[model samples]
Structures are given as C-alpha cells and as structure tokens.
Target: MNPIRRRPHIDYELDAGGRRSLWQTLPTLTPGLGVLRHYERRWLRLDGFAGIAVVAYMVPQVMAYTAIVNVPPVVGLWTALAACVVYAIIGGSRVLSVGPESTVALMAGAAIAPLAGGDPERAIVLSSALCLVVAGWCLLARLFRLGIIADLLSQPLLVGYLAGGAVLMVVGQLGRVTGTDVEGETIVAQLRSFFSVVGDTHLPTLAVAAGTLTLLLAIVILRPRWPGPLIAVAAATIAAVVLDLPAYGVAETGPVPVGLPLPHLPIISWADLQTLLLAGLGVAVVAYSDNTLIGRAFKPKTEPGEKSVPDVDPQQELVAMSGVHVAAGLFGGFPMSSSGSRTALAIASGARTQVYSLVAAVCIIAVLFFAGPLLEPLPSAALGAVVIYAASKLVSIPDIKRLARFRTSELVLAIVACLGTVLIGILAGVGIAIALSILEMVQRLARPHEGVLGRVEGIAGMHDVDDYDQATTLPGLVVYRYDAPLFFINVGDLRRRALLAVEKENEGDPDHPVRWFILNAEANVEIDISATDGLKALHDDLSERGIRFGLARVKQDLRTPLERAGLVELIGEDMMFPTLPVMEKAYLTWAAEQAVREQTALEHQAVPGADEPAGTPPARPVDTNESDR
Candidate 1:
C-alpha cells in the first residue's frame, strides 16, 4: 500500500466521534508542528521579513517592559524567547506574539515588591515562581474548560483598568525620566516624593528622556508602521556613546550578562508559594484575557475554502499558554502576556505562520549572546521613555467618550474600576471589576424591561404599546412580556408589573375591565421555585378579579419546573398555549361569550315586570326536557 500524505491545511484539531488514535491526536495538539510539517517555500520570505520587523520592535520594547517587572533587562529577552517559541509551537492563533506585556509586568512587580523587600535578585526569583504558579493555574483552567473566564473582564473594565495602569506606569517612571530617585509605593505618595525632589532633576537624563519620547511620539503619529521605539532607543544609544552622557550624570543600564540561562526550576519556599498564589491567579486572568483578545484581533484572514490557518480555539489557547508560561518559568523569566505592538508589527510586515516567531526567537538568542555589551551604554531614561510611550497608548480616551455617550451606567462601572485600580491596587481592581459585573447582571435581572404588548396598525405581530402611538390593544385583554428569566430576585417585579397592567386597563375603561391577562413567556426560558409560586399567586389573584389568566409561548425548560412546582396544573392546560396567536384566539372567543351574556342580562333587566305599573311584554315559555324543531 502507498503511504498516505496529509494535506497541508487539514484541520486535525477537530475530533469526530473519537475516531483518531492518540498518536494522531498528539501531533494535532501542537499546531506549530503541523505548520512545520506542511511548511511552504513561498512563505519563507514573508515570514522572514515579518520576523525582522518583530525583532526590531521587540528588542527595545520588551527591554523597556522590564522596568514594569522591576527585573534586569536581560530577563525580558528570556521571556520573549520562551513566549514566542512555546506559543508558536502550540498556540491556536498563527500570528499572536506573546512577550513581556506592560499590564502583566506591572502586576507581577507589584505582587513581588513587598516580598522581595527592594532586592532585585529576590524579585527575579519570586517573579519566576509566580510564573510557574500562573502556568499551573492555566493548565487547571484548560483541564476544566474554563476559557469563559477570559470574558469575566468586560470591555469597559478593560478600558478602565488599562487607563489606570497607564497612569500608575507614567507616574512610576517619573523618577527614572528625571533621575531624581523618587520614593513611594503608591501613586499619591510617589507624586509627593516627585514634587519634593523636583529641584534635583538631572538635566542630562531629562533631556535624553524628552528627546526619545518626542521622537517616539512623532514617529508613531507620522509613520505608525515603523519601529518607532526601536529607532528612538537606537538614536539615544548612539547619542549616549558619542557624547559620553553617563559622565554627565545620565545613568546607563550598566553591564548586562550575555547568553541565555539554563532551564531549571525556580527555587522558592512554601511560604513564598502561599503568598504568590493569589497574585499568580490574578496574573493568569489578566494574561489570558490579553492573550485571547490579541489572538482574536490578529487572527489571520484566509480566502474562502482555504484552511491555511485554523480558527482560534479558546481551550487550545489555554493549553498553549500553559506551556508558554512553563517555558518562561524554567528560563528564569517573569510572567508574560501577548504583546499588541509586536503582533501588529508582524501582521503589517506580512507574517504567514509561526515561523516568524521562530525567526524572531533565533534573532533574540543572537542578541543575548553577542549584543549584550552593546546595550551597556543604553540610557535608563531611554528605557523609561519607551515605557511611557507604550503606556500612553493604553488610555483610549475615545472609547471612554463613546461609553459615556451610549451607556452612562457602564461608564460609571468603568470609572469605578479605574478608581479602584488607582486608589487600591491592580489585584483589588480586578476583584472590583468582577464584582461590578456580577452586580450589574443581578440588577438587570431583578428589574428587566417589561411592557404591555399590542398590535400596531401596519406592523405584524406585537410590540410594546408605549413604543407606538398607533398601537391598539384588545377591548378587555392585556398581554405582558418580561424580558428576563423568572427567578426569585425578579419574580416579584413580574407580578407587580402584571398587576399594574391590569390596573391600568381598568382605570382606562371601568365599564369593561380587563377580562383576560396573558403572559408572553417566550423570553422567560427558566423558572425557579419562587417564581413558579409567584406565578400561581398571580393566577389566583386574577381569578379573584374575574380575569382569566393564560400563558403563551412557554418553553419546555420553564414548563418542566412549573409542572414540578404544581403551577402548570393550577393554571390548567386549557389556559396554556403553544403560541401567542392561539392564546389570542381563545381569549377572543371567551370575550364574545361574555359580551353575549352581558347583552342578555341587560335586555332582561330592561323588560317590564308584572308587579310594576307599566304593561308587561308577552312571556315565552320554554320546556326544560322537550326539544323544539
């Protein structure tokens, strides 16, 4: 038999009926291997160009992010190496670039600061341990299919959180930018310290920072596709070396060790592990959110019917990220997240596959080995400038304005999250964001939008009466629709609104009060015990008022619970309908019978009696047992 060759773009990730053997599944799990196995020749040049662009953008940017991590600049290269290589190997997204991200770096630094007690060496160790713990968390989340956790941090919160982090970052760098040695852990205290030392600012460092920042901003505005930060950093480095800026009080990065560190487990105590657990989890959440967001944003576009790059799988992303962090930890690097700047650069440079990341990794390894001494003259102020420039992009003023205009309540949430992050801490801010999200959800469910439905003159079906001036309702019937599930917290609101609807109808026409009240229950997909009981009470109240109660479009999910709660039987099957039109037909028939009875009673009342002075009409006798034909 001839050996079968797998297609270059076949989707081996999807398992149908568990038919594929474990050996086949194992290779599919690592998507990078698939890319390598089917590597195309035409993509080499494109990926190579993209890889060079990534290297240009990353060398300075990742090193600058180390300021946020409070680690040595060399560690950033290690993080970049591990993140890119490992993520390329198993990552679901073809173009997502993972590295030392500002937000995650800030979080890791804050988490380890107290434990490290100002010791850089201890901070590195703690950061590495934290990375391992984060890896463990990612693996656990993947094992349990908890990828939905990424969505826990909503868009508004993200905007607010990043904005607040930006403020913290900019403030934190004021010392380095000015060479004034500002001292404080909090923003407010830092500002105080900064003002106190304002007079002591080193002119050389301040000038270097100003020049670099201006160049970066100008390049970003004028030529966004260029490696602005790299250009700025290289310019500053050249200026530093030529002018001997360090002799004039400009601090340099000093001597950086060349080459990569050997892979080994991060040494830490049990106490350290206990302390880092919560921080690690926080980092994991933030990192995963960032990774997923960037991955989605940069998902490669393919022609129709082409399967060159598979769609992003959130579960697979978690597994891939777990491996990335594991690699980072073993390489003695701090926690990392997807880098938007580098990924954007790669995309703009026309990257085709994970090979670009491999190319960038190879370049990073070379830089670490040979170019470490070249970075010795790199000014600290230049690095701070790079960080400030990156942080400035995170504010997103336009998004905040949009939120303010469209959704004021959500804007309030964004503001609260921002304040919490700024006033308390990043980790606390995450907690507040989650709490606000849950609270908003509960509040919405507790008092969801509801209205009396009626038919408009030209529109089909039913809509809210208040929404249309020409909408018409049945003479003595009210149809109410609630837009959320019927639960304990919200069942009371439903009952209240239903009763109010009836009262409104009666107030509008007392002579022919509401005779039927039908609940349009299509949106009420689930019902709890309390809600079922509340519904039963509502039925009894309507019956007492001589108003018939009916339900239309009740889902089976809700009906099962209603049946279990005895509400279905209490209301009776005759009063339940599969659709709104059928229920409306039943109500119309009942209304006609009611009208006939009312007319008969009125005619009999108007007839003269024998005891009255007026003449009586001839009586017609009716036999109870005989049939008249």
Candidate 2:
C-alpha cells in the first residue's frame, strides 16, 4: 500500500532520514518556521489567492455556525484558527476545509444540554467527553478498517436526512436573523415571537445581516471563488463601525487570539459520557458520511492516465476526522467536521493538493494576529445568513424529485425528516430519519419472501410454485424455500408458512398428499430459540401425520445450533443433506421404497381373496378445525 502523507505541509528542514520518523512529527512544529515556509514558497501567488479567499468566507461562516450551537461567536473563530493549524500537518484531502460546522456544534450542544445547569464549566466538560468518544471511536474503526458502515447510510437516506436538516437549520436561524434570542426546539416557537418582537428588531443589525446574506448568496451563484463571506464581514464591519451599529444593539465578534493554542484535555465524567453517547454517534455518522463523500470526489490523482480514483479508505478518514475534533475539544476550540461547502469551494478554485489546507492554515494565523480587529462589527444577521446559506445547499429539490421517481417510501421518509427538522431540532430530525430507515429495513427482513419451489416448463431451475405462472409441482414432494434468517421477529410467520405449505399440498390431492417436505435452507444462516421451537412443533405434527421431512443446503454454522437443540437427532441423520443434488437423490430412493410398500399392500389385499377391496383407499378423517383435524 502506498503511504498517505500524515501532514499537508511540505518539509524543508527535515532530510530523508528525519522525514522517516513520519508519525513522530507534530503540527506544533514552530510558528516562525510556518511563516518562513509561507513566504519562501515559489507557489506563493497561487496559494495566497486561495488562502485569502478561504479565510475571507470563513469569518462570517464561522460566526454563523457558532450562533447555531448557541455558543459564543468567538468559539467558531477559535475553532477555525486552531483547526487550520492542526490539520495543516495531519490532514489528507487537498480541498477539505476543517472548521466549525452547524451539524457538529448543534450535535455537541444537544449531547451536553442535560449536563448544563447554567454552568459553562459543566457544558465544557461534557462537550469534551463527547469529542473524546468520537476520537476513540474513530481510531478504533480505523484499527478494524470498518469503512462499510459509512455507506450503510445509503444515498436515498442521506439525501432525505440532509434535506430535512437544511430546512430546519434555515428556520432555526430566523430568530437570530430577526435579532431575538427567542430559541425554540421547533418551528412554531421560532415564528411564535415574531409578532411581539418585530417592533424590537434592531434595524442596523438586521440591515447588516440581510446585506451579508444577500452578498453571500450572490457570490455562491456568481463568483463562488471570491470569498464572499470574508468580504461581506469586512464591508459590514466597516459599515457598522461607521454607522455606530453597536449602539443600536447590534452584536459583534470581539477580539480573538491571533497566535497559537496550548492543548489541554476536557474535564469529563462517566455520567457525561453516558449522556453524550447518542449525540457523539450522530457526529460520527455525519462526519464520516461527509468525509467519505469528499474523499471520493478528489479522484486521488497519482498516475496520469487512470480514469478512476482509488476507493476511499473510510476507516482512516474517520480516524483523522475524529482526531481533529478531539484536538479542538481539548484546546479552547469547539467541535467541527469536514466543511462540504468549503471543500467544494476550494476544489472549484483549482486546489490540487492537500497543500491548500496547509496554506489556508497559515492564512488563518495571519488573521488571528493582524486581522482579528477587523471582525469586531460583523453583524449577527450576516453570520445568520452565512449559516442559512451554507445549510441551504444541503436541501436539494432535484434529489427529492429523484427519490420520488425511485420509491415513495424514501420520499416519505425524506419529507418526514425535512418537516421534522423544522418542527423539532436538527439532531432530532436525523434521529427520526434513521429510525424510519431502520424500520423500513426491518420490515423487509421480517417479511422475507418464502415460496414453494416447483419445476417450470421454460425455466431451467425450480421456481416458486405460487409466484410463477407456468410451474409444475413434483407428484408428492412439497418444497418450501425460506429466503431470510430465522429469528424471533418472524417465528409466528414461520409457523404459519410451514402449516400453509402442508395445507396447500393436501388441497391439491388429498389421496396423494405430499409424503415428504423438503426445506430449502440455502438462506437460513442463523436461527434463534423462538424460530427453532416453531420448527420443532411443525416437525412433530408432520411426523405424526406420516409425512417425512428433509433439509437441503443448510449453512455450515447452522449445524451446531440444530444439533445442540436435538433438532437434527429428531429429524434423523439420513434426512438432512448438504446440497440440493444430494437431497434429490435421497428423495428418489425414498420414493421407490414408498411405491414398493403400496404395491405390497395391494397384492396382500388381492391374495386375501376378499380380505379387502383393492379399489378402496385408506380414509382420512374430515375435519375443519384443530379439534377435528
């Protein structure tokens, strides 16, 4: 395997020998060295343009998401500042923008809300615990190399989930955009206070925010590379300052440290860990989904002529992503994830390597030290617009249309999620969508397609007797094929299916009822007690009726479970076969023996010279209910 670089920045001081100690080097490498590297590069012009643009848009975007978390606006700036430095050394993607995000912050707040007794200390500790869990979980996933879990969310579900979240995000920010802290868990509460508070709206703040949102949207539509958020904030900050907007109750992002951060662990407890477990999982799921998506988009360039990029190693991406957030939590930074919008922006602006992230980091340091003061009067509305617009991208009308084309179940779930977000919270909306997804999956599994196998005239292989139009059943052999695992969820259904197969066999010809039932156990991988008992009951009933039973193609692991339960012993060693061919051969031999027995009975009756009439067949009692049958 080719070794992926741990850091994005190119090494100047380290020789090949020093660089060989790859994992040991840290981003805490030296600030002076970073500045020197930034200025000494031949690619300075290209990087400078990209870096400045990222930093520009990042300012207001940072404040917007920070407010969504209901945290101090400075936390967002601090997060952007710290993450750019940390990921500069360890990040993998060229276009990845690591910073505060609406999803992560909103999730963090939800996880820590229970622990907050109006105490910032408690919130901080709980939040850190949550990040720790994410980091540890991600690293563990990497160790196991479990990337498939990310795709488990699926395209349809993701579209639905994001669409719901985006709508909720826009609605949630309405209060802030209108200059009120009227927070609610739902849409109605947000719109509830507007009647009384419209008169209280801060005109200057609204004006700046509205202008900023409009500008950001326009940039996204027209020249997405211009770093519109950064420009808007700068322009708005100047306007606010000149017009004395703060005097009209307009908020501002005050001073932020422009230098370095000293990392420290977050204070936490076992209780906090328990409380935040669900929220942490939400972060894990969303972060990996976003990371894997972006990593695949990069088309990992190596050979010039390769048409496809190598598949993303999702487990590793999770570990890297979780590590960044953990570091952020440990330091004075809030949580973050791969910024999908920003990553798209960077890629669209012609970023070629992960070096873009490194350059972006250097640019952020410059902002902290030199341009921190310029952010002072950035109005809340502009930040709100930044968030609203960022989130708006997540809602897709085309995707919803596609979902409707494919399946109604998916469309309904997506709609439910979208509506849920506005009615509930972002995290809650995600939870609802997941629950719906899982429910749909379980319904399919629980009602697995089982059928009676019958040979067909045109089809080469045996097909379902009831499902196909031109299938013919064997004379007296009943074949039941189960297509899902046997579990407690469908044990009752299993019993009913087994009994129905027998009833169907007798209904066709009671005199020549199926003498044997062959269970096609190809899909029966595992079995639980309830299903085993259901099978056992059917086995005893069939045996009493003189109907023999046999199993074909039971998986290897299922043998022990059958043996341990004495099911195999009761069914007889000769009855269970490894493959369908073996079972078919055994059935032929059994059919011959049954024919001989019938012939012998007829001969005995004829020889008896009137002991009994050969034309008369043994009678089966007529009964409709269990009491009579």
Candidate 3:
C-alpha cells in the first residue's frame, strides 16, 4: 500500500509593532475617508463644479420645500447645510445628496401642524423634535440590522403616495399664489375656501405668480439642465425690489435670520415627545425608503472583471442617515430624506465623491451668512411657483399608465392612496398605503403556488405536469411540489391541494392506483409548529387511503422539526430519500419485485392451489407492504 502524503503547514505571524491597531482601521469604516485615501487631483475640479451646480439647484428648491414643512425658509437652509455635511462623512453612497425632500417635508407638516395649533414657534420646535426621534429610529434600525424593512412599502404604494402628496402640495400653495386666506384640512374644503375668497384676490400677487410660472415653465422646457428655480427666484426678487411690489399688497419673505444656526437640543413636553415618537417612525420609514431607492437607481455600474467601487451597505446607510438627521435636529431643522432630483443633478454634473456634498454645504453656509438679506425681497408667489413646479414632478403619468396596463388592481390601489392623501391627510394616506402593501403581501403568502411533478421526453428533470402536453407520470406513484414555506397561514390549504392532486391522478387511470405519494420539499425551507401538525395530519390521511407518504429533497434544517414532531418515525425513515432520481429508482426496483410475487401467486392459483387442498379456495395475493409496490 502507498503511504498518503500530507501537506506541510506554515506558520503566519507578525510582530506587535508591525501589526495595525484598531484606531488605524476605524477610519475605513467611514466611506468618505476610504474615498479620500484614493483621491485623484483631476477629480477636484469636477467635484467643485458639481458642488456648485448642486448649490444653485438646491438653494431655491429646498427653500420651496420649506413651504410644505411650514417652516421659515432659513430653516430649510439649515437643514441643507447640516444634512449634507454630516451625510458626506458618514453616508455609504458617494453621490447621494441628502437634504430636505418634498414628500418628507409634507409628511412632517402633516404631523406638526395639528399639534402646534397654528403657532409657528411651536411648529418649529415640533419639527426639530421629530427629527431627533427619526434619528433615534434610524440608529435603532442600524443596531438591529433591519435594513430589509426598506422594502416594506411596495412600489405601487409609493406611486400613489407621491401622486397624493403632489395634489396636496399644489393645493397648499394656491393660497400663497392667489394671496388669499385658504384654510382647510381637505382638498374639497381648501378649494371651497379659495373660491369663497377668489373675488378678493390681490392682483399684483397674481401677476407675479403668472410671470414666475411662465418663466419656470419656459426654462424647464427649453433649458432643462439650467438652474431654472434659482433663475426664476432671482428674477422675481429683483423685480419685487425694483417695482416695490410690497406697496401694492404683494407679500415678500421680509427678513430672514442672517448667519449660521447654533447647535442646541430642542425642548419639548413629555406628552409631545410621545406624540412625536410615532410620527418619527413613519417619517423614518419614508425617508429611508426614498434614500435606498435613489441610492440604488444611480449606483455606478461596472463590467465583469473590472475593479468595482465599494458597495453601499444597507445597515451602514441607516447609520449615516441617523447622523444626518441628528445634525438637522441639533441645528433646529426638520426630518429629511434623499432628494432624487438633487442626486440626479449631482451625478449629471460629474460629482465623483462625497466631497461635492461638502462643497455644497460650504456654499449654503455662505448663503446663510452673506446672502440672507438679498433673498429677503423674494416674492411669496415666486416661491409658490417653484413649489408647484416641484410638486408637478412628483406625479408620473407614464408610471400610472403602466400600472393600469399591467395591473388594474394595483392601479386602483395607487389612486386610492392619492385620493386618501388629498381627501384625508398626508400622514393618514401614508398609513393607508402601508396597510395596503402589507395586506397585498399577506394575500400572496396565504395562497402560494403548488404543482404536480411529471417527466417529459426531452426534459431532464421533473416539471409541472400541467405545463407540458406530453408529460407522463410513473404508474402508482405521485410526485408533488409546493412552492413556498410551509407555514400556519397556508398549511391547511397545502394538505387539501396535495390530496386533490393524488385523487385526480388515480381517477385519470383507475387501473393504476396511486400507492405512493412523494413531496418535493426543496421550497419548504421553513415549517412552523402549526405546519408540522398539519403535515402529520396529511400523512395520516394518506395512510388511511392505503398510500405510503414519503419526502424527497428534504432540507437539513427541516429534519429537526420533523424529528421533534415525531413525523419522521410516523412516515418511516427508510421512505425519506435525498433526491428524486434515487427515490424513483428504488420505487421501480420494489415494484418489479412485487410484480414477480403477484405473477407467482397467479400461476399457483391457476394450477389448482399448489400449496393448499384441491377443494379449498385458491390463496389470494396480499401486499406485504404497500410502500414496496
């Protein structure tokens, strides 16, 4: 005999001084530092230009979103500055621009307006408190590695939610543009209030609104890549100052607080804290959902064998956003999420890393300190026009039409969500959308797909019998497959469907009774306690009908539950096979042996009871074990 050759081991070691310490490795945890470690000089100019573009785009757009949050326009600047700076350091994505977004702003307003009771000061405090609570929820999610919850809200729900929010936004700005006191909680009531005061509209404000809208539409249609909102706002501000439109009863921003915001925790009552906590959870879900969606949409693509960029970790994203909202709360801003439009703008302008976000932050700081007075004369109508434009982008006619063509039910759900938001409120509409998403998921789980397995002439493995016209099944055998986890929700249904499959097969060819039933258990990776009981009942039913129950392709994890439930003993350990082919081969061998025995018994009976008295009845053939046949 030849001796076996063993591979030699080599020791791996390094001196303590040569080894890297934890502190040195800690910096890599922040994606920003990792990108900086490989920074190129050529990217500097590109990122700088991208950052400038982001500033011009965000300044007017973010200020307009503040109208949704019902906060001072300066507070929006605070949100942009703090969120962008913090996200640049801790965020997972290189190009994602985190800041005030219209949907989240609208949701924040919905939660705060009711509690503040028309006090703007109280509303600001509530907004800041809500930011802190949202930060807490994000941090909690990161700690628990619950990033998968981002998919809890379905796409159909989001479509409807955004559509609903757009209508609410346009309605909210009607009063500003018309210079009337439009006050109502619902769209119907708001329109009624607006019409009641339509006769008393301020003509100068209406004129400013018309000019601003026309300029915005023209720029958007002709020069889409241009800073349309900024241009529109600047022109209106210049006109307001030159024409003295305020004297004609046109409302202006008046005075914005100059300089940077001081970092301080917002104070609130314990009751308010409890109220804000719930609102915070909703806001966090929406923010994270949008952030993840945009982050994935613009993720840089690479070809095979190419060195790719570091992928964004979902859990790390939660941590980064937690820091972003914490910064916002400290700076007296509101809850914020990633703006898809701003992110697209940054990417389009050649942003290569988070450094662009830092540049944008610096520019916003400059605006907050040096340009606040310049914007004081900006007309409310122009801001309203900017907001209405932003809102219009939220509704996608193509998406709605696609849903209608592919899934009419989902289209209806989306419309319901929109109507719910307009008729009810932003927060409640979101609640309804989330509920609908959950219900849709439950409906799918409660009635999963199942199929009967058979063989086709050219097919290599088992396939659904219903799918193939020429598929054939083995005599006296039934192979079945259930394409979902065996849970309490649908285990009873599984039992009924499986039994019906066997009965249908037997009835199709009564001469070949189904003596063996085998389940393809590859998809049943999980089986809960109730499902185990249900499985046992199924086995008992098969046994009563003289059919032997067996399992094929059982997962390792499923063994312990089956063993604990005593199902393994009840079904017989020998009947469980590792693969379908092996099981089928063994069944064929047994069937051959049974056929031989039956033929022998028939021969003896024809020979006038070879083993019994001549006058006695011929011995009847009996099955030693039905499973063997």
Model 2, 199-250: lDDT tens per residue? 8776666777788878767776797667777776677777778988778787
Error of 1 at 341 (Å): 2.3
Residue 22 CA displacement from its true place in model 1, Å: 4.3
Evaluated against the true structure, the overall lDDT of model 1 is 0.87
| CA lDDT, every model vs. true structure | 0.87, 0.69, 0.87
The sequence of per-residue lDDT tens digits that candidate 3 reaches over residues 183-257 is 876679889999999998988998998899889899989998998889999999999999999999999987899
In model 1, the Cα lDDT at residue 235 comes to 96
lDDT of 2 at 271: 71
Greater TM-score among 1 and 2 belongs to: 1
State the TM-score for model 3.
0.93
Q: Please provide the root mean square deviation of candidate 1 (C-alpha atoms, Å).
A: 7.0
Q: What is the C-alpha lDDT profile of model 1 across 1-629, one tens digit per residue?
A: 98998867856765433468899878767988887888889888989999999999999998998887788889899999998899888988888898888989998988888788778778788888999999999999987889998888888888898888888889889999999988778888989999999999999999999999999999989998888988999999999999999899999998898988889887888988998999899899999999998888886545589786656778888888789889999888999889887888888888888899999999999999999999999999999999999898889999999899989987988999999988888878878887887888899999999999998987889999999999988888899999999989999889988998899999998887887789999999988888888898898888888777888999898888888898778777888999878988988876676567666555656674644455766344332112110
Superposed on all Cα atoms, the candidates' RMSDs to the truth, in angstroms, are 7.0, 9.2, 4.5
Please, what is the TM-score per model?
0.90, 0.78, 0.93
